[model samples]
Target: MRLTTIGFDADDTLWQNEQFFRVTEERFADLLTDYAESKHLKQRLLEAEMRNLKLYGFGIKGFTLSMIETALDVTAGKVPTSTIATIMEIGRELLQHPIEPLAHAAETLETLSGRYRLVLVTKGDLFDQERKLAQSGLGDFFDGVEIVSDKTVETYVRVFNRHGDGPDKSMMVGNSLKSDVIPAIRAGGWGVFVPHALTWAFEREEPPVNEPRFREVPDLGALATVLAEIEST
Candidate 1:
């Protein structure tokens, strides 16, 4: 692989993200238990979130709205005003939560930054993503940052054109097979999947079964070793 640029997925790949969402979701379910069963509530919330994606894009604000909509739906428009207030509080707390980088995340980025053009490519609410990136302390290591609405093969091509030579010389490192890996490979780039234990269900997809440029490592700590091997051969 003759990789000259490396793109990174910000949320689960660089820091602890989905874990917070999972915690907040559990709290959301608990908050509405009196109105509906936990399993049913979860299913409803997921459905709402998926449905709202096109309308609200992606982020905490949209999630907050979805939670409110689900709460209303579950209770047939009778969910208490107090419960609505608490759900808003949940969204506020999540927005203010500290950004905790994964173990070895900074170290790995520092190691790779000097060797390649590092770009942070992630999709979400622009303001929230920008806030998290500022708080992460690893922002200085990246040559560019692309906060996109979605990750697709065309998106990868556009990002590479803006930051690097092209897709063939670029590599994407991320947690989601759907957003980060498959699309990058389809765009003619190398893709390194660093699986996170707690992935959101919507981001899950079957791995590329036999793609030569597709690679998977246990975590960010193993990335340098993988790159070194790739460079040696």
Candidate 2:
């Protein structure tokens, strides 16, 4: 069947996201330089983030807390209060980072807005996601918006069904294979991988090698053409 619903991931897919997090992490490592090396500190912070995901979930707030926890751990609870404040400040900066829409992001959305039922299926802090969308000036192009905590097969099934025909007639396009592509394809929808320059370590996964519904494009600029090919077939 022809695709009807198109779900786009918000973070690195629509706008700049991971780069801010990387910069904040560098600042975080600098704050703990006295206690640990930068490389070791980064590893510890990643561990803290993974361990705290269930408790804190995703986004800047959780990431901030993880930095605090890692600092305390590395310093044996002796990380200075001033340093903690600095880390928090860095996190705040990340929260307030300007929303930069990636190249072709706007025009792609503009092209597909009327032709398909476009829904933003993104996962992150609710307020931050909302803020980015508002600032993007492309919110009007989406028929629906889903700021989910995580993307899963069930999430795709429900989102596609609610916004359009069903998972069978839907496509989820984004930069992360694990979150945006894999689950959507598993849920009986088309999964398009548009790899960003950087992806979170935890979100990396092997692509579905033989999945006919899976398509990888260089960027959003080619998204419309891929959809056209899918429709023709």
TM-scores, all candidates, are 0.97, 0.99
lDDT of each: 0.93, 0.93
Stretches > 4 Å off in candidate 1: none
Error of 2 at 1 (Å): 0.9
Give the range of the ten consecutive residues with the poorest summed lDDT in model 2. 25-34
lDDT of 1 by residue, 1-233 (tens): 57789999999899889888889999999998888898999899999999999999888999999999999999999999999999999999888778999888999999988789999999988988999999999999999999998899999999998999999989999999999999999999999999999988899999997998889999999988878877887
Best by TM-score: 2
Cα lDDT tens digits, model 2, 1-233, are: 88889999998998999999998888887777888999999999999999998888889999999999999999999989999888888888888999999999999999998889999999878998899999988899999999988899999999999999999999999999999999999999999999999899989999997999999999999998999899998
For model 1, the run of ten residues with the poorest summed lDDT: 224-233
TM-score of 1: 0.97
